[model samples]
Target chain A: MKPAIKRIIFIVILVGLWELGSRLGLWTELILPSPTSVFTALYHGFADKTLIWDLIASFRRLAIGLTLALIIGTSIGILIAKSKTADDTIGSMLLALQSVPSIVWLPLAIMWFGLNDKAVIFVVILGGTFVMALNIRTGIKNVSPLYIRAAQTMGSKGIDLFIRVIFPASIPYVVTGSRLAWAFAWRALMAGELLSTGPGLGYTLSYASDFGNMSLVIGVIIIIGIIGSIVDQLIFQRIEKSVANRWGL
Target chain B: MFISINQLNKQFLDKNDQPTTVLKDIELDIEKGEFVSILGPSGCGKSTLLSIVAGLTSATNGEILVEDKKITKPGKDRGMVFQEAALFPWINVIENVMFPLKKEMSKQEATAQAKKYLQMVQLSNYLEHYPHELSGGMQQRVSIARALAMDPEILLMDEPFGALDEQTRTRLHGQLEEIWIKTKKTVLFVTHSISESIKLSDRIIVMGTRPGTILTDIKVDIPRPRREHKEDMLELEEHVMSYLKKEIDKVVSEELNHETSH
Candidate 1:
């Protein structure tokens, strides 16, 4: 069977098993909602337009945070890659900072920016930027020295060298870094929304849990996974594949 | 003299901070439009000499001058072709050829110039092809076209055909010879192949290993269309190989000694 079809079948089997377990009372509906109940909740969310608003709100936060992270992360990465002193000083500090879980920044972000969009965005940027910077640094480092030498001989120097040779060659790594940054930003956004007052999926999920709306909570969780997968499969994965194809990697 | 190297020496500091000499007291005078081959075994520093001349590396001591002007860094006047084609994988063949020209010419002119060189290298049909899509020989040809498109006064090739198969190498030899004849650029080719040196070079500088220095410089007086003069070429090849064999043995013995010491 084709891999796509096989994957669909696997998902169907999982849903079927879940539905059967719920029907058999293996788990109470309060604890584990049936697939049908989850779907009904999902349908009602769309009918009421609340789910769309939540999605828009969550995506808005992600876009602002991710853009900021990419800008800061890429610059830091290039700086670390270009200078030995920066690599030793700022680079080591970043490595140490990366070890701290991004969630740990939530309290600090809240304290600094308070319970507003700024707080969530700050947390998202904090979560995403370090991993992106590290990946971009690695990408720059791993570019073959031969390419640099070749470019130099072709009359490229300084900024020309970076733009023409180093940047293009390191694109695959940068794309990979973006994907990881998105994942981190997504996780951080959720944590932020859960704690702060917001109209995002995380906020709705916490509300549902508090009100004992099990199906709504389950539906929101599925939406998070779906959105993450959609971005991965549709955008980043395609970019990676095209790059690999072009470079014959 | 067009390109002159006087009392050139290069050394490197090993991990132990001991100075290891790679080239010593190298002197050469190359005329305008001359095709010179630096022939030597592995570790003979022939490539290093070529790199220094190309202004890609600086000699620890001594100087190189082109038309009496000192060379300190890589410039458009001197172009280098590496053993590995080193073509940009992200760009197409025509773009790779046009890369050096972009700074000097408009996009249209660069395209036209690149096309002319690609045609000269018989790769006009593969203009849009990416580097990885082409065969190794074809890729090297693109690199040659790239270098040629620069229209440099000197072309420094460090074993450009070294990685190709025998058949590809032989065919490229003919193409390279023809290009040399047509362009009349002062060519400095580094190679280990004796026949390739005799087949193309106006002068072959045989080098010795272990603090690399020239052993002899033999001028090839054999006329062009060398394929018609196989017997004469073979005789010259034998003469070059005889000198090279001694250097090869010295390298082998050095390797064996190092291994035993280890």
Candidate 2:
């Protein structure tokens, strides 16, 4: 059978099993809501426009945070790659900071920016920046010296060399960095949103859980997982593959 | 002399931080439109000499002058082709050729110049093909086209065909010879292959290892389309090999000694 068809069948079987267990009273409806009820909650949430607002708000924060992270991360990455002092100082600091989970910064971010979008965005930027910076640094550093010498002999120097040779050669790394940053930022967003009062997937998930609306909680969790996979597999993975193919990395 | 190296010296600190001389008292000169090859075995610093002349490496002492002007850094007047093609993998054939011309000409003019050289190298059909898509010989051809597109006063090539199979190397020799004849560009070619130096050069400067110095500077008077002078080419190849044999022996013994010592 076709792989797509096989996957569909597998999903159907899993959902059928879950529905059967729910009907058989294997557990309370509050603990293990049937897939139908979860889908219904999803439908109602979208119909009420709450899910739409939540998605918009979540995406807006993500876009802003990721953009800022990429710009700042790339700049710092270049600095670390090029300068010995920066590599020894800020580079080491970044390596250390990358180990700290993004959610661990929630208390500090909340204290600094209050329980607002700014706090969540701050956490998201932190989540993405260190990994992006490290990847970019590695990317630039790993550019073959042969290419640099070739460019130098061709009358390329300074900014021209970086833009034409180094940057393009390091594109495979940048693509990888962006993919990792997206994942990190996505996780950070969810964690930060849990404490946030604003309209967001995490906020709604928490609200549903607190109100014992197990179906709504399950629906929101499914939405988060689907969005995460869709963005990664559809967008970032495609970009990475094309870059590797073209660059022969 | 169009290009001259006067008492050029290069020293590198070895693993123990002791300065080891790589090239010592390397003096040579080349006339305009002359094809000169620096022939040596590995560790002979022939590539270093070429790199210094290309202004990609600094000489520890003395200097290289192009058209009577001392050169300290890489310039548009001197173009270098490394052993590896070193074409930008991200760019297509035409774009790689146009790279050096970006600051010198408009986009359309640069494209025209790039296309012209790509045609000269017989890669006009592969203009949009990325470097990764091309074979090794084709990649080297693209690099040669890229270097030629700049219209430099001197062309510096460091064993540009060294990595290729023998058949491909022989084929490229013909193409390179044709290109040289058509352009009459002053060429400084470096190679380990004795026949390659004899096959393509107006003069071959055979180098000795261990503080690399010129062993002999032999001029090839063999007629153009040198294939017609196979006997003459073989005679000179043997002559060049005689000068390199001692150096090659020295390198071999040094390796053997190091291994046994370990």
Interface RMSD of each: 1.2, 1.0
After superposition, candidate 2 runs with Cα above 4 Å error: A1-6
> What is the DockQ for all candidates, taken in turn?
0.69, 0.82
Question: In candidate 2, what are the lDDT values of residues A1-249, reduced to their tens digit?
Answer: 999899999999999999999999998798889998999999999999999999999999999999999988899999999999999999999989999999898899889988899999999999999999999999999999999999998989999999999998999999999999999999999999988876999999999999999999999999999999999999999999998888876
Interface RMSD of 1: 1.2
Per model, kept true contacts as a fraction are 0.58, 0.88
Once superposed on the true structure, which residue ranges of model 1 sit more than 4 Å away at CA? Answer: none
Q: In model 1 chain B, which range of ten residues has the least summed lDDT?
A: B238-247
Candidate 1 whole-model C-alpha lDDT, 0 to 1 = 0.92
- On residues B1-262, what C-alpha lDDT tens digit does candidate 1 reach at each position? 7899999999999999999999999999999999999999989999999989877889999999999999999988888899999999999999999989988899999999999999999999999999989999999999999998989999999999999999999999999999989999999999988989999999999999988999999999999888899999989988888888888999888889999999
Write one digit per residue (lDDT tens) for candidate 1, span A82-126: 899999999999988888877788888878888789999998998
TM-score of 1: 0.98
Across B180-203, the per-residue lDDT of candidate 2 in tens digits comes to 999999999999989999999999
